[model samples]
Target: MDIGVALRDLGQVDSTALIERVLGFDEQAWVENSYRQKQYDVHTLTESVVMIFTDGKGWPNIEVSKESGWDLLADVAMPLMHKIIERHYPPGGTIIRAMAAKLLVGGVIKPHVDAHPSFHVGHRIHIPITTNSRVRFMIDGKPNRLAVGNAYEINNQKQHSVMNKGKEDRITFIFDYVPPEQLQRMQQMQQASQ
Candidate 1:
């Protein structure tokens, strides 16, 4: 579905500062081990953090990569996230299931579709920081470079992939957005017609 005409600008937060804090993170805490697929070009990096959020019903995964430790949803990052949620998914709406944050050292996620459940509700959004121009968002068989201060909405239900061709590690804050009621209604109608 196309983005609504009345798109909202989630307040801008200090992207650099937030990333700095994330890099300073300490990984002493023992969390569940993460799953890494061999399909994506994997490599070791300075440090990275993967955080997952579930809205109960749908899958809403958000991965925030930093130069080091992961610092996401800081006071600065909150506003933008809230605005995104408000603009795309209504309050208390959607069933967010999982989120992941991966740090790529010039790594690439081979072109592929996300898990089936992920395609049903939310679309993935990426925020590039500390990343070089080599990083690209391949959506619908087209490559789109993510601009640092700009937000782009992606239909994960469609085909897409991530690539970081630069030498520097690319950190993208990725998350999912669910369609609001009106959009959902239209989706149902379209499906019924088909």
Candidate 2:
């Protein structure tokens, strides 16, 4: 997902509905899918309501499926996601992961690259639903502030992290998208292996 840059500002969008929807979820929803936090030590202070996720136990060929959050957020999230995609990405890409991730007040997502094979190719897009001035998103040792209503594509291959020193929790809707060309290449590779 390294677009040869630290951050690519994909401009702004109307996230009012998405924001309202995310705020409606109960506290229990955030903890329902603890996979990200459990697997990555850096995300221990974070909680997520994962909508679509991939089954990539063996790597390369992955299976994507809808999780619990899909029921809660898809109606509002999908339209926004699609709008972003239509404007910024190629048609017919697959979203391997989609979720509303929260960094609790005073939490820090220690700096690290997204090392998974999927992350190497997919675009890691983020839309901040709620953020405070104190939240700093650092990429490669530099601090960048991501605000609400704006979308960004981050280079997940490089070291990146976030720290929420604000009084309110920082929430962002993130998704990993594999453009059609990249997806076709992966499919061919998988078939060749078989």
Candidate 3:
């Protein structure tokens, strides 16, 4: 499929209401995790560095629990997300997950692939809430800065990473989308191939 078609702008979502939902909202209600994997550039595992909204199982250093990250999800991000998913993502597809991440002054997610070995399909999308020149999404080994008013679709199977060289914090909205066809293919591949 055309991965480029996968990335589309859903207009400006960084509205006042959205900002309020993020800043004023309670992070305690949602599930989150703290990650200190060396691959992600964890200089000090002791310090609270990362937070995520995953199922909370795989990684070793999980800082915030996914249960607590639920409160971190914002309402304004939904409409823009829906517009993109409804148009491109396959039927029966759901935004299976989301993450509200913080990249501090020195925080960095080292070069890696977003796709797991389990599934060689689907799409990885990102919405930058706050970013700067230092923060980047390296797709296919090429680095890209998150521009305001732009949404990005990344080929997670390719090597990627993020770097926050600036002093201010960088936050982004991230999630996964599965095409029905790809999901069915995965099931079939699992049943027959296995």
Candidate 4:
């Protein structure tokens, strides 16, 4: 699977609520550099990420060696997060990480594959809150634009990159989870469509 579908509508949820909460954070709250900063510092994609939920050790620790914990920001964003989880995931899907990622205009994420063990075999879902047509999320060279309020499952295991050529910032609520059957079903659906 490449650029995936919206699997679920997710249209009724007010995406602005999540966007407002994300924007409420102070400048210092955003994690400017990607975790793999050493490798691609020159063309680094700057994202203002507010980690709402993460492994116990906190942000930048993508590998969950222990139990997970909700950050302080999660309290403010819990209502919307629950709504998202309920809509997409099963009763007890394992949520590895959840964050509000904001990319500024002209920002670009150089092509790279997230090859971590945590990323493999899991689904990375994006719920775009504020975005425009110029925001291109490329998966294996094909460009994809996720409209506001819609959810998309991106195949992060493949080489992918993002560029926001629009004037407004592109904000998305990203969630990583290991669904028992939904991921398999989505892949099958993609194959059938192809």
Candidate 5:
């Protein structure tokens, strides 16, 4: 259960299309509906997330017992996303949830653990599309910055939080997947090679 604190880099991908797509959206397109943590009543931290693929209910609802389906907006952006997913995740794994999360300038996600079964049973992968050095992601109280275009595997079962102190919004594509045993073996091989 101790997955270590190092950020596992899954290499980089061309995030041009993804960044363009996100930047093209209207200002009102970002929806503020996240159940991960409660916004502070005194100092509200505005954030938003769009579900591209999910358990079929909708955004903000992480618990689902049904098959995953794409949202209408996701259908339109599936081509690029599919390419990214296929290149990284490939097939044979169960991807329970996928979304594009946006943290506005000066926003913060209070520290909390994603204790849901869905989060505990899978690995959370993050592909930062647009980010800056000021955007900090804290996992178990350690702050880390995910640079744009790089893919990283995060241990979401641990206590984590995000803060956007940059002047621009921080956007990232996140996916939850139950990785196949083969993938684990491959990672072990990689570690041995190192």
Candidate 6:
């Protein structure tokens, strides 16, 4: 969504629980979901523990489902994701995607807007679990540094990119939400087209 700004700070959040659980996951847990990297080649340098995802393939009627990482991270991840949503977003919205993404050292996600249909209406939120000073996230060509203990909602409709030049990998939990009213209008439009 083009939130009228490049990024909106959603204030701070206690991500200790989620961070601990994510850091403890074995290598296999991270690789369990290769859909992001496989489907979006630009994400090759990143890995994710995806809890839920919706490709918005069946327009007017979206398909959302729990992925393998749901079992592993839901206990700790849900509370954080929900807390942020309930505070800033309205009720009855659909969370199209949720995951903890890792940008490996020296990783570079080239500048690009999220072109998927779901992305147009979904509010993309990001919470930094771990980050170093060397990491830089560019939103609308402006350099922004995301800090831990804070959450931000980025306008996915604008151009954005990330690069991790730090020695350690940068980890951030992200989720996409489509508000109830907007979602309803979106579905209706798609149905009319069909």
C-alpha lDDT score of every prediction, in listed order: 0.50, 0.92, 0.53, 0.63, 0.62, 0.91
Give per-residue CA lDDT, model 2, range 20-61, as digits (tens).
Answer: 999888999999999999888999999999999985666667
TM-score of 1: 0.61
Q: How many backbone clashes does candidate 6 have?
A: 0
- Better structure of 2 and 4 per TM-score: 2
Worst 10 residues of 3 by lDDT: 43-52
| Tens digits of lDDT, candidate 1, 27-111 | 5411233333322243223223444443223212222233111234444454555666666556754423222244565666666
Poorly placed runs, candidate 5 (over 4 Å) = 1-3, 32-46, 52-90, 180-194
Which model scores highest in lDDT? 2
- What TM-score against the true fold does each predicted structure earn? 0.61, 0.97, 0.69, 0.68, 0.69, 0.96
Per-residue lDDT over 5-76 for candidate 3, one digit per residue giving the tens place of the 0 to 100 score: 323444454444444555553443221344434333432221221222333233222122333445445346
Q: Model 5 — TM-score against the truth?
A: 0.69
lDDT comparing candidate 5 with the true structure = 0.62
Over 1-194, each residue of candidate 6 has an lDDT whose tens digit, in order, gives 98999999999899999889888988898888888889886799999999999877877577899999899988998888889989999989988899999999999988999998788888999999899999999999999988899999999899999999999999999999889988889878877988
Which 10-residue span in candidate 4 carries the lowest summed lDDT?
60-69
Query: How many clashes does each candidate structure show, in the order listed?
Result: 12, 0, 20, 0, 0, 0
Best-fitting candidate, measured by TM-score? 2
Extract clashing residue pairs from model 4: none
Model 1, residue 171: distance off in Å is 0.6
lDDT (10s digit) by residue, model 4, range 1-194: 23254233445565676667676766656654344233445235555453533333322234442212135346555666667668766755566667766777898887878755456646687878788888888877787767876667788778888888999877777877766664465446557766
